[model samples]
Target: MNSNKKIIITAIDQRSTVAIVFQTITIGLIMIGSAVGNIGILLAIYKTKSLQNKTSIFVANLAVADLLAGLLIMPFMFICSIIGDWPFEDASCNLTGTFALILGAAGMNTLGAIAYERYCAIVHSMVYHLKITNRLILIVITFIWLEGLVLSLCPILGWSEYIYYTNEYLCTVNWAHDVSFTYTIMVVMYFLPLGVMIFCYASIFKVARRHLRQLAMLDTLSPPSSHNQIVSDSDTQPRIENSARSLRLKRDIKAASMLFIVIGTFVLCWTLHGCTMMCLALGDTCPVDFPEYVYTMTTWIAMFNSVCNVWIYGMMNRQFRDAFRSLCCIACLRSSNTQVIQI
Candidate 1:
């Protein structure tokens, strides 16, 4: 080749190499961080009694699902990015792609369950305890997992099938083929769960607003005690009125706050991808083609929803933080002991 042509080819090769390396490192780090964060939260929940509850169990299920995605799915995606092709054979692609889809579906379903749990606790406070038992929660979780598993397995069983996208550098459900099946799956798995989440959170927020308004009214009625006035039982009526529901209300409020953050983040991360998927499903051809980096970035952002949950829930709860600290201390002690023995 001439010097000028050779220089152009070298620059192109260099750019491609740099892009692959950057994508590989970025996804690898994301996987590591998500794995570590989710594992820490799991251990924290196991070790801390106070962190164990119906809602926490559901949240932990989400973490477990997301952790598996980070461990199984994201690595394969990064590998595809590096290789610039789908290196795996048909069976491997199907298995990994099915799993990735299953976990994602499960995570969203679990979030909907959490929203419903919060709604029940806040809106129908009277019957919430009776309605939301540990046994019942476990049953619901089992149903969520089973639903995702069944839907995910449909493709593997040859209902829809899996395809490795060369351009995007990922393996996912073959939604581009069989528009009818794609729309059906979208409605059953994605749209239904999304609708449930919206409804539950909306109801919870409405109840929260009403509760806050009531609290305000109560506060307004209870005037500050004057220095000259003698202390009276009437002065403490507001406290008496609040005492019954205060703890439960406060707990629900925190639960709502934490879960809201999670849902908001999840939606933010996945909205673009979801929209793109829907748009493609409706069109005659999957016309939307993003550049490699843009597609990869969007997918990773959605994957991040899984990793971010443990941090969101942990940060909001003191018990979880303490448990995480204890776990850290134990890890440190083990490292120190190993060093001493080596010495």
Candidate 2:
């Protein structure tokens, strides 16, 4: 084994056996949780007839991308953790690293799509129905995956390669001290998406507030003689408007809020990883041992985005939540019927 790999084994071996057990349990939990969440979203979307709307279609695509992340990346990470150094040969290492990076980028871009869609639905409600065609939504989804594919291929196409520091027991893209690359990635991957999401969400909040004010105005305004019937008519419109507006606002708020929180978590988790790479590129000696541990934890935190996105879908959207519940209930019913018949 390499010297650096020896150090990692020594360090991790120094920990109490209990610590290893706890770490194992945590990894297992994350794997299982991610599996259930992803599978639930896919099944629910496919089975629920009413959920065939444009918004749900996009959400289902997001769920599928996230599912790939959880299934493809998480297991590779777990294997790396159990064994110090890359267990696989060079080709496998490159493939694993590329898959993780691509799926992760795709998942992030999908969140951008969700944010933009919500922006139109809430901020430009009148025109949203007219302008947001099924074809347009398909184009957006296509663009997101394509962008991710191109980015993930950059490193493989002689731009960069996997660097296994052995000391880190992780595989990540090579970090060059090139300021231009650093700035470009930070802008493209982090800053641009973050900025767009924030802007759209801010607009969503403003529109929702205006919608509420409109409802209040309708409630306060009254009519003249023969006013009773007019008042009823006025009341009917506002009530319907308020109910629809409120549902939309609530859904948008939850979805946007969830994305913000998850993306923020991604930023926090990956910041140290990015910083360490930048420092390495600049030829600065890093506090490697500690930062490696921190980066590993952050990678898990970023992985949390995949697992959490499904829960967000279930929580924020009523149809998704209901469909998931119904699916579970039906599964149980089938199992029970099988048992009774067997008896």
Candidate 3:
């Protein structure tokens, strides 16, 4: 009996050890991947003049939020996962939690902002060109950051509270601290933004489809013999207007399609975390035995949003891919020059 008991205890310890190892590996990948992808996005945008536009401005804001999560919060979350304790002092803990929350709220909102920008740029290009200025976008971005600040500081200022959730190995806003406040945050900070993203993307898709149908009609009407026809025949004004509109419509479709991919990825990554948080908010207090690692894994899954945005940018946007390739080419050339100098 004694020998059997010893064997079972050893098996349990080994299982626990394996679990921790797996958790560490998972969190490490998320942390490293988020950092690398986000930094690359920033660098690629900075080096490419074509990408330095209004759409990219919103993306840059989102990147800043992800960069903060990777650089500041993720490492600590990883450390806590490994050690199973909040080793830092109370102040650092509170401040870090607040910072993460604010950035996260800001980042998520930035996605909505991007969606809105795309909707305006593509669905109403003429209006967008006339009314949307760099100064206006800058003001909007400032508002986003300010909104995040207010949401994050609310907890610190006693509207709600944030504390370490050991199960997830990160400090987050207290789910049950002030039930009403938690519900408010979940709705205002998360749901509304998600809805806006969905609506904007859906509207963009509708517009794109309508445009495609129009092009198909145009293709049917166009004659093969007119392939070399001049864009402006005798009515120069109407022809020029139509030509410009066609060009703007095509640009809008491409831009909107790219951002739609990004918003889809965001929805996928965030859904799991949102559902879990929703359960907590709704008072799901069943005492059923659940795997201890599940919550932490869910949180890790959310961290992947930071990682996926970069890949989405690379995959969905031609300009982004070209920018990345050019940046890599420059780096390679620099390395070769250094090698030649050494030789």
Residues 56-104, candidate 1, lDDT per residue (tens digit)?
A: 8887998899899888888887886687666666677778878877898
Under the 3 Å rule for N, CA and C atoms, how many clashes does model 2 have?
Answer: 1
Reference-based lDDT, residue 151, model 1: 82
As for TM-score, the candidate ahead, 2 or 3, is 3
Alpha-carbon runs more than 4 Å astray in model 3: 1-15, 226-253, 284-290
The C-alpha lDDT values of all candidates are 0.75, 0.67, 0.75
lDDT (tens digit, per residue) of candidate 3 on 1-343? 1211111001222237677788888888888988877887899889889899888988888888888898989888888768766777777777887888888888888888888888887677669966668998889889888887888888788886777776777777777667787777777667888888788878887887787776666545553335576654544554455556577667767776777677677767777777666555554463433355556667887888888877876657888888878888998999999999999
lDDT of 3 at 116: 84
Off by over 4 Å in 2: 1-16, 165-169, 177-179, 223-291
In the predicted model 3, the residue pairs found to clash are none
Output the lDDT of residue 208, model 3: 76
Instruction: Supply every candidate's count of residue pairs whose N, Cα or C atoms clash at under 3 angstroms.
Output: 0, 1, 0
Candidate 2 RMSD to the correct structure:
4.0
Model 3: residue 245 alpha-carbon error in angstroms: 7.3
lDDT, model 2, position 218: 54
lDDT of 2: 0.67
By TM-score, rank the candidates, best first: 1, 3, 2
